[model samples]
Target: MPKAKKKNRRKKYNYNVDRKKLNRAFRKRQAPRIKCSQIRHAWDRTKSVSQNLAEMGLAADPNKAVPIPKFMQPVMKMDIDGPEKKSKIVQKPYVLNELEYQASLPEKQSQTLSRDLIDYVQHMIQNHGENYKAMARDEKNYYQDTPKQIKSKINVYKRIYPEEYQAFCTSLQQEKMDKQ
Candidate 1:
């Protein structure tokens, strides 16, 4: 049997260098160059460094460069006898009193549940006792919570208000005794 002839699939490569086209392409891709003299001329002695940079279309933080006034600059003091003498006075560290420290601190925020949620928990407990499944199926269970979720809420209520929970249990017991 005769073998089939394979077709040439190689791409044609250009070896010629076009200097004019290369230079034009490079110029188009390059950023606009700024001379040192241009920058010096654009800068204002009265204005801040950031302001000058911003006016020249450069990214600079407004607060980064703060210009100090001539009067605010510290003057070099010369001693007649020798070099500059340092001040002997030492500053004492400030100490806050207990009451003052307490007053300065932020007040604690309440993280307890809302009055409505607390009431709902109390209602559920009164109606269903320890039966979380019954609580979950209750008519007042508007959230349609699972038995596990109902039990968790009840546990939270008991943990948060131990005294109130104890009082509630005693009241239920008293009612049961009265019935008997």
Candidate 2:
């Protein structure tokens, strides 16, 4: 029997290899071409060193460029001649006498009792008679003063407005005198 003929398969085209070849061709064609005239006019090793330095502004004298004003320099320190003396700062103490201190403070004025307050106290004294403490606790009394406060306020009232208090004291003295 004759052998079957083998089939010849075509190879697949590779895109990467084709693309690289096209890029290489384009780069070579697009490369810049330098002219001989541009190179001749350009700075090269043929130019003198002094001419290159002058063109760079390095060859000019720095002193002749500009005069920096003398006033710009820092001021010198003043000459302090003799040996250094250490001077101390002294603070004075507050020395005030008792009278001077009292004079400096504000003065408190004694409060004067009103006629209505005097009358009220006289009425309470007449009704309660020596029982001021009970009158102080009574709700009917205008100022529900505590026993201690009531005593002090009565004493102050007697001193300030003494007419009623003096009359009460005189009557007591007269009763004692008559009994004697």
Candidate 3:
């Protein structure tokens, strides 16, 4: 029988020099042309664009170019030389009542555990009691979570459904009493 050819498993790092050169030439051709008038004398090659703009005295700060007035400017009304017209009648804005406002609001959604998750927690508690290590090792624990992770899941369940969790604990205690 003829011997099979050995496959090369090593990674090849071949740099395409021709492609790099072509890309560099293309980028140079596409470079933006800046006008002589656009170039400021106050501009520092080492400093950023904003710092250069601020140094030029063209703006106080590049970010806050437009200065905010300390007081609101009065609205100016101009009289036009045209035929006299009747004043426009203004209507009051429609206001919604409490009921209407409540109706307009979105309904609140309550987060509840899935049946499978609830059953999983119940099974873990029944099989392992408070021992998270035992729960983590349980065959029902398909996710193969650590003991800390198992404890955190149980804590989340307890926090989300405190009353239900309390009732569940009572039921477990009753089951133990019955067994005795």
Candidate 4:
């Protein structure tokens, strides 16, 4: 065979580019006609939705809220009534479901209620039996949630269980943080 033609070396191709200029090209191009302030104002109108976006890790925008120092706010305080009285007077101490308590309220009377206390009373009647059996059940759950047993539970812990509620809150906060 005739001498093979000398192999030609492949020429190296280069795509050298300036990073800054490339980045500028890739960056989001703003509609020059749209004013930045007007865009910001439009975003402000969606404050709640935007806040949720940050919560969902969809945005880096800082929250527009003042941080309340932990010390500034008192630990939670639950206004617990006496065990017996609480059963008779408060929302069912052993409420199995929060939704059910809400559902039990009369469609209209629940609305007429001017304050939370009235709404609570309505909840109590449903959770605790309206009669003696209900009262007994109420007493049982009240004691379960607290230390004092039965009527004593009611009489001894007549004040709101601010400490107990606070403890529960701390536990919940810790649990949430752990989940995070």
Q: Highest TM-score among the candidates is held by which one? A: 3
| Best-to-worst lDDT order | 1, 3, 2, 4
Ranking by TM-score: 3, 1, 2, 4
Local lDDT at 122 for model 1: 90
**Which 10 consecutive residues of model 3 have the lowest summed lDDT?**
88-97
- Give the best candidate by lDDT: 1
| Stretches of candidate 1 exceeding 4 Å from the true structure | 1-92, 95-109
**Tens-place lDDT digits, model 2, residues 1-180:** 876565455677876588877898897676434243322233245556444334433334556445566886678856589678553222211212332565689977577777787766666665566686887866657657776776676778777757767888688678779989
Error of 1 at 171 (Å): 1.0
Q: TM-scores, in order shown?
A: 0.43, 0.31, 0.43, 0.14
The weakest ten consecutive residues by lDDT in model 1 span 87-96
Q: Which stretches of candidate 3 lie over 4 Å from their true place?
A: 1-109
Listed per candidate, the RMSD to the true structure in angstroms reads 18.6, 37.7, 19.8, 27.2
> What lDDT would candidate 2 get against the real structure?
0.60
